[model samples]
Target: MFSYCTDPDTLSGFSWLSCYLTTGKHMAFYRAFGTVLLLLAITAPTALAFGFCGARAARSQVAPLRWFGKIYIAIVRGVPDIAFFLFFVIALDQAFEWLRHQVKCPDWDEPIRQGNDFVVCQIAKMPLGNAPQWVHETYGFFLAILTFAIVFGAFAANILYGAMNTVPHAQMETAEAYGMNRKQAFWRVMVPQMWVYALPGLSNLWMVLIKATPLLFLLGVEDIVYWARELGGSKTARFSDYPHPDWRMWYFLALLVFYLGFTKVSEVVLDRLMTRLTRGQATMGGEAQRKAAA
Candidate 1:
């Protein structure tokens, strides 16, 4: 991308490597790594929020709300992730476009789904056909994030729902005896105690979520996996600057290291968090801390 790097064939040694690394596509590749991190950063909390709501709804007094929550959690958790990711991306995009078409082109009468093709009015396209490339990319990335949140949210809901139940029955009874109703007891007694039990399951989910980030490429997002293969594969003289032999093995090896390091760091942080949350609780962890002090 640099001015001096324009004539790549003439360059060699350090200059060739420098030019090759700074190409426009390579810059995009670097940004793709950041994109993966961004997806994880955004998805984790969003999924947690969704899971919290779903878990609460699953335990709701109202029948319809409880059914909705239970079904949402069941369907997502029951489906294989690869199937869900592949299907949801297309389903979500079409669902958005279908809604847009209903609002924007109500007079246009045609089967939205005709045989294999899912069609919408031109103006109703999710990003609009005339939108910039970046807009299209952004829309795809946002959709991937939503799909991920929905899937992981269900997983979290199942874990949290169980965790809520795992809290001692005595605690809820004590709260009720102290003039707290079911609603008050749940918020005051059950919710706080659920986290210690929830931590272990959620920790596993966090690691799985980290591993699943590579699926961004499957969702049509230009993610790190896409770039790793693109940049690392052998490039002929006509195709790329500073042509290289196959290096995908090395590229993926780096990815392996990145994930392992990330998982290690997550384990350390979660262990400390679990210790803090378990303090003074009736669990074994809490009992040990109590004994240590005594």
Candidate 2:
């Protein structure tokens, strides 16, 4: 960006490095970091909501709802996660386009799948072919978020279901004795107390979620991994400025450090949160906290 950066060929040492890092593509690389954070921000709560509903269904008194929940958890857990990621992105995309095709081109007489190609009318194309580049990117990111949520939600549901059961049976009994209905007891007594049990599992899930962010590359989102591979590859004289040898190892090393730092910060925060949530509860951690305060 500097005036002197006009001649990168003459630039050397830190000057060349500075000009190289400040290029437009590097700016995009920096923005991709925020995209990773954005994915985490959107996915975490959505996954939790999905998990909550799944857990509630699993615990439902109705037979069908309970079975549905059990099937969801079992099916997701049975398959490798990468398989789901690959399958769901394409599946969800086609499902959306199919709905659009049905709505927009109701009279069209063509099968959506002709051999290996998934063809829909131009209007049914996701984000439309004429749409801005950002629209395409945003659509891809949204699909990635949905994939992450669906996969993580099943695991979170299993954790939450177990946590709900770990809540003492007598607590519900006391709530019922006080004339509260099942739903009231569940909300006012069981749900409130289950977090202490669930925190450890949820914390572990959070770390897994963090590690899984790299999978965004597989879904075609321009995530850090994609940018790392792009920016770290060897550049010849035929290319524009900022030529460099293959530095993917160093780029990946930076990613490793970033993830390690993120996990370390998360661990510290989760520990404090666990301590806070556990305090005054009728659990071992609560007992220890009480003793320490005394």
Candidate 3:
């Protein structure tokens, strides 16, 4: 804010605009962009790890493990993402609190589920009653990350499983012929080769994940979308120093430009990654690269 920001009545044009953009709420709006970026950075890798585990489990020699992985993939991929987001957050939150309640209040004679209310001991609360604002926000963000990971991870698992199968059987046989065991062949041969096949699907998944960041508002994270809607709504002179007509359309347009630009950058990066992964390999992409170089 500027020193002249103290008197909004006399401020006009660029002066008013600068002061408006530098308000406490506007600073929060700026920070919300970072929140979205951080969510993507953290969730992408965590989701990939989850998918890797699920994919490996689906292909496991043990029937129980394989069945578990198949069921997980089927259930998650089949469910609507919005429905999953709504249901899973509450379920996961309650599950955590319930576990904590059992440990922290072993002698309590009350049932956790009393009609519609799910009650827990104060100490068992996720952030606790006395916890600071950041702790509550962090807890909500953590839940959002987990929910996003579980949903996206299932789709990633399916993509990876198919990619693993697309690697030629002869490659595995050759590894075995060279005295490598199944695990060694998998890690050294199949896994390395699968990325070329998997990249396209994973790239699309990444885009979907980017679009899905708005769902953070549903989980109470006060993300970019939340801030945009809040700040863009019409504010009256009675409510605050700055008053304006509804500007939600402009705010949403800004969001549109942001997502479009972000996706464009992502496409460029993924293309380069695909090119690097395909070079010198046996796939069609590699074959094309070879011909181009020649």
Using lDDT, rank the candidates from best to worst. 3, 2, 1
Task: Extract clashing residue pairs from model 1.
Answer: none
The whole-model lDDT of each prediction reads 0.90, 0.93, 0.93
Off by over 4 Å in 3: none
Q: What tens digits encode model 1's per-residue C-alpha lDDT throughout 1-294?
A: 778897888998988888888888889988888998999999999999999999999999999999999998899755579999998898898889999999999899889889999888899988988999989989999999999999999999999999998988888989989999888998888987888899999999999999999999899988888998988999888876578899999889988898899889999998998888888888898999999999
Indicate the residue-level lDDT of 49 in model 1. Answer: 92
What's the residue-level lDDT of 253 in candidate 3? 97
* Alpha-carbon runs more than 4 Å astray in model 1: 1-19
Candidate number with the higher TM-score (2 or 3) = 3
TM-score of each: 0.91, 0.95, 0.97
Query: Which residue runs of candidate 2 sit more than 4 Å off their true CA positions?
Result: none
What number of clashing residue pairs does each candidate have, in the order they appear?
0, 0, 0
Predicted model with the maximum TM-score:
3
Query: Candidate 2, TM-score vs. the true structure?
Result: 0.95
Sort order, TM-score high to low: 3, 2, 1
Answer with 1 or 2, whichever has the higher lDDT: 2
Candidate 1: count the clashes.
Answer: 0
